[model samples]
Target: MSKFKNLVVNLSLTLGGLFMGVIIGEIGLRVASIEGYQKIGDFVDSAPTSFHTAHPDLGWKLKPGASGEWKGEGASFVRVNSNGLRDDREHTKAKPPNTLRVAVLGDSFTEAIHVPVEQTFWSKLERKLGNCAAVKGRKNVEVLNLGVQGYGTGQQLMMLRKKVWDYNPDIVVLAFFTGNDVINNSPKLEYDLYRPFFVYNASGKLVPDMSFRKLAPLDRNQRAVSFVDRLPSWLVNNSRILQVAKKADLDLKKRQISKDFTVLRANNFNPPKDAVWDNAWRVTEDLIVTMRNEVVQKNADFLLVVVGDPIQVNRDPQRRNKFMQENKIQDLFYPDKRLEKLGNREGFRVLTLAEQFKGYTEKFQVCVHGFDNSVPCGGHWNEIGHRLASIKISQNLCQQLKQSQLPKR
Candidate 1:
């Protein structure tokens, strides 16, 4: 009986010690005020340290000289060059002798972390263009990928000014993703304030808004409450050690289950529903024109490549028709057509890929947007999609260059 009582007392003491340790650790962490070790929601959607770092103007950029295994719908070992480009080759600010340089810019699709650097559209385009008549006079073709994940058109324009002009690209290709670029450009629509935004002033001109850099770190109030809500809210909120541990656990789980795919909603591909969306579209168009003007000022040819969303290129006609019908969307090609018209009106070349991709998907009946690790028909472009993009973009550029004289060496 004495032994049993002693055992109970010892167990109670051990529990008390653990509880005290936790309290002390929590207090120490709070007092230390270590960044990312703080409260919940402080670092939500924060870029991985291995791949990205915060930028003053662009908000987030690929960490220069960083290499990591990117596991999304598709998996690849991605490396960022010293210039923060996702390329295997290093580039100098000056163009190489007798070489034609093409700078490709866009968001995640152009950055292409889901596939190998060699297999990306821009890399493949470089190789493909080498054989084309477009580079008949040039000894080499260099395609510089200035793509970063989650970049809006506004950010791409900023990138052109800050980084791209240094390389002296003879041509600039803007790979516009119809998926969420409209929302990405609009401050009113995109809630993430870490990135740069362009807004229209009272004078009806596009004004750069870099206010996000000066703003305090956004609070978690905007984030939807998740399973964490099940825990004691006060305890979770107050305990920094607990939040750090929870974040680590979640990170581990995410790494373990890396097959999560980003399947965008139907509305993302549809026409504007309200004035906010209308403004987003207008701002996106203005941003594109701004990019064109910059490229023109540098005496570089600009090609606006309108990338088709997965649904627009779905192989199954029934699925495509059903999605359009259910969504009440008159045309799946609406965004593509609109951007193409903008390019035409603005005197910049446009290449719309949705109709061609739809035909290719129907003919080949192969998955372009996903991988074996993810849904076969959704997410970022797979190897086949990249290959198709390289083929089409190379062909288009070749034809354009054939008609127009190549930039002088």
Candidate 2:
């Protein structure tokens, strides 16, 4: 009985020592490297460190080597909030009183990621529109950007209804991107690379995915798992691991999954093309109609700007097929010429860079937008592409505002 008591005491001491050691080690690790610890909401806030001091409007990290007060390396424009919205309380010549406030909505392209505040298309348009003296004093054209990365037409419309409409804007600009917008609508496991999970019910009310909500409770556990996941990505991404993993994943997916573009494209892929495209289009149309009705209710002007992806804008036709082959990705509902035709027929003001900047890359592999010649790293337009898009959009907006002044026949 004495021996048994001794053994129990020893065991308890060992377990206590182990627990204390773990606690001490965790505390030491936390204090030793501040950079190792990630703050909560860092992903949503755009900045990984110091949320309080960070600019609320510019959440995402700009490109490397970005400079200038008005512009940054990857960004195309400067976003000004209501505090900076006016020069004075009375409004300046640039921003006059009673001027029509214009709100631009879209994804990263419209947001002008990695660029400076002034270089964004919206900023350029504001500058151009400010030059008009006829309505300059009488009215001001304030352009507000409510763009979030990875947002689709449906999300943008929802944002407008929830946030943008309250600003009392006279005109709303809907900048539509062709790449990945359709794919973004479906449910998926991946969150960091795309927008978080959200579902629109039959009543059209947006709701957070229940699974996502459940995951939130397990954030600490997930964080620990993420650390492990990052280990493989870090080592492999830097060395032979990445190559091996990439090859293995590709080979496995190829052998296991059917190579049908339409089949493997979306999360929900059983439906026919007409059903899929029609459903997406219907959702988009409903959102637009909802916005239009809201606009009428609030007496605002509505304009749709259809922006194309580099792949779609290039209109090479072969590019989509090539992409599918290279990435082992299915084309899905997009790359369908019929969809593009339908978008146009539905009165969407289509602005394709391929059509806008044709034959400009004879000597160099320059995109229509005139930035450095490189295929997009992640499926988004580079700085130069965004700049070109902004310029074109601003020009059209200016023309539209001027036309609004002409007497109706």
Candidate 3:
């Protein structure tokens, strides 16, 4: 009887200890989260709206006929056409005659739902193009924003293959975000697990698949949440410990990324003569080549527009250097140079937004991609940034066309 009683007592004590430890740990996490945790676990409830609808082939898309006031960091009135783009007007699959149609394909930067519709870079460019064409006595010009947030080049290529040609564009502008797009091209990158990924073949060929080489891997990691991520918002918002751990986890992942993939060296900004870098380059280049050929087949002029990362072009030299140090980068625009070189070799025109943004930033003393203080850098181009991008693209396109007409002078 005494033994039984002692056993019961021991079990009770163990349960009590565990219960207390959990409570204490939770409190510790809450106390340590100085700025509070935001991107914990899956962040399922974080999206401000249901603007994106998933597609089997396209991966995801802006909902067709979705009209609402969607809010991210900033509020914007979003209206998706019947064809599922954030355009005020509907576009037909068969473009009207004398209409110079342009299609812009990219990720969130291209979609840019954070700002008002009129302020989006593509919108500004469309208006500018129209006005310019009118001045030149040319036909009507229409620029279509076919960008979807979080789209990788694979998706962009898919868009080109399956959708963009439906509009029968005269020009196709591909907005390539150099930062994440590189990793997104490789199935080995963790980001590839969430979205569709591409891989190279035994013959050193590029193939797009969301699989582990031959088989599709389980996306268990994407939907899985850590113990801390499962906590209530109030606790997470207050827990500095959890926030620190999460940041450490992110830092650790970045470190692992360097090990897993052949990343650009910060010291030289060159992709090392390694297998990972080679695979990534081949995969991405193949996609670009495929896209260019497809656009050409459709009788459209293809332009690879390289978007500069904010860290590479921040107005503050110190902050920019720190960002480079964190990423171990030296040239800052290494990816830009690498892509530009590839485009040049392949006879494709690559227009970089880095020079434009950097030049404008030098004069204004204000950032085009980010705001001041705790607001956090947007990383997406702002109104001023978008306007400049439009001008540069328009000017370059016009110049190239004129040069082509120069009769080999």
Query: Which numbered prediction scores highest in lDDT against the true structure?
Result: 1
lDDT of 3: 0.72
- Tell me model 1's lDDT, rounded to 2 decimals: 0.82
Tell me, by TM-score, which candidate is best.
Answer: 1
Q: 2 or 3: which has the higher TM-score? A: 3
**CA lDDT of 218 in candidate 2?**
18
Error of 1 at 307 (Å): 0.7
Please give, for residues 1-409, the per-residue lDDT of candidate 3 as tens digits: 9999999999999999987887787777656643534445332322224887756565568888988786555557888899988888888889887887889999888888767888888887777776653324666778899998877798789888788888888889999987677666765554434456666679866666644323222232432334455567676666566666666665666677655443432322446446776676677888998899888888789999988877666777788777567766657778788889988888889998886687777777777785332244445776777778888888766765556556764
How well does candidate 1 match the true structure in TM-score terms? 0.81
Cα deviation at 401, candidate 2, in Å, is 3.0
Residue-by-residue lDDT tens digits, candidate 1, 29-135: 76887423334444444453468888888888998898978876589898899999988879999999999899999999999999998889999999999998757
